[model samples]
Target: MCRLTFFVVVLIPIIFGFCPPGNYEYQTNCYFFQNNPTGFSTAELNCVSIGGHLASIHDGFTNSLLTQQSLSFFNASTDFWIGLDNLQTMGNNWYWTDGGTFDFFDWSNGMPENLQTQNCVAISMIDGRWSNENCFLSKPYVCAINSAATTPPPSAYPCSGGFLYYEPTNSCYGVYTHQEDQTWSNSESYCESLKGHLTSVHNYAEFRLIAAFASYGKYAPWCGLFSNDGGRTWQWSDKSSADYLPWQPGYPSGSGPCVALAHSGLINADCNQEQPMICKIQL
Candidate 1:
């Protein structure tokens, strides 16, 4: 008889704080625990606004991690609002407000007194112990978002130009990064076919928006703005007045025949370098 043996190795990824700015990572979750004191309802609302919910700990490791973080930041073991609650079903098994599975509980001694008035849950920053509390009490909180979450683009709005609409200017704008990178001139030409020009940044809002896109996509986008005659003058390809210039600080490094939206701001990029682009059309 032949004997065969196989050995398997499991690797638990060591990715601490692999979350977005102002967040910490544990296992597969990103936590944004902070010192913003608010009522349980208000805290949940705040978390929801940022694409997450009050933190939910399903395992002892996570509970300990959250407790340690709270201690490190707030310097005390005070109470911090968590996602567990029984507001909807008093005197029954609690539920996570974020809808996570309630498979674990770390109640402090004499917890869940099952008082009629106490319908919310909180975790002790001191040692990760949980306790029941009145839902109206204000407390600091932890919000947990999916580590795999993404910065989703705006929902596609119906417009005649087949792109997102800018109600402020009665124009349509489009960002095209999915296509193969192309020279700035070619980008502008493609926009021309759609009866548009490289998009212009008329205000700070558009500037920040393009900057966000560049940061997330890891690619600068060609715009209509360009400089000629040694950076002394710049103009938009569509003949619009260059009313706004959100250039990267200490940039224009040199006179650029072309410009692209960079993470920081507009930067002079070699026109021939293939890049993505944003276009706009007055519909």
Candidate 2:
């Protein structure tokens, strides 16, 4: 008779206070739990309940590995959950769990065509491609709890008189608000009085913050942009458009007289419609 015996001991170091409650980063000691197969929204709630959030991949390398891991966990046949979801409206709108806009766009080639209502975002193993999937479907997910702060965000935009919050990334400015609602012209005047126009968010991060502080009662905001110059002639109040923007569908419509920034960051709506507006300040 022959017999073989083996022993293994695994030690998991309990790092005390590595990340604050409900905080996460990339490439750090982040906690991941695979249980109770959940959809995108449920998954986010789950992560949040555990003092964390759905993972966010900032770069290509991590994005690739994450997609692969999710596919493997789900038997390489089905999709799993991730932090990305376009459940905002229906068009090309996406947001991350960490209160940031979807700036790191890596959509599969010829994808996001909005071929169907599958607007929710998901990752795939077939060459780390990202595709829109049903938010109700359940799949394994690769989320980060605490990784690392990749780049030091740019300082908030400079506001002189009233107040200003600068976004270090895009050099964009946001207005400090104490109210839940403001009018388009009123917000515009508020920003103008301070020598700054309403906030003109050029990217997603600022959009996230703006949405949180401004968006109330399903209303968009009248950002520092307008089609008055012409249908395509949209410009920021700062008289700068160096960073060309890609507007979403059914936007800048002639019928929609007033324009307000949508919570999704890419879309804008009419003014009277009631959306969040930025209260700019002088810089």
- RMSD after CA superposition, every candidate: 19.2, 14.6
Error of 2 at 206 (Å): 4.3
lDDT per residue (tens digit) for residues 1-283 in model 1? 2221111111112233358666688777788876878777667655654556689878998888888888766654388998877654454768786677899999889988966778789988767788999877878889887787654444322244335454456566666764467788988998898898988888754553344345334577888988777778889999988998877766777746799986556888788987778878876
Weakest ten-residue segment in model 2 by summed lDDT = 2-11
> What number of clashing residue pairs does each candidate have, in the order they appear?
1, 26
**TM-score per candidate, chains pooled:** 0.48, 0.48
Q: In model 1, which regions exceed 4 Å deviation?
A: 1-18, 156-283
The CA lDDT at 155 in model 2 is 33
Candidate 2: segments with Cα more than 4 A from true spot: 1-26, 29-54, 57-81, 86-118, 121-167, 170-182, 193-196, 204-216, 230-232, 256-258, 264-275, 280-283
The residue pairs found clashing in candidate 1 are 77-126
Residues 1-283 of candidate 2: C-alpha lDDT, one tens digit per residue: 2121111111122244454454333357464634456566556644543434577767887777665555435564555566776645455456677675566867778877653467556666566767878766776665555443232223322323323233343332443333345556666776676566776655554454454333332345567776664455666766666274535455656644345655444454555553455644434
Clash number for candidate 1: 1
- In order, candidate lDDTs are 0.71, 0.53
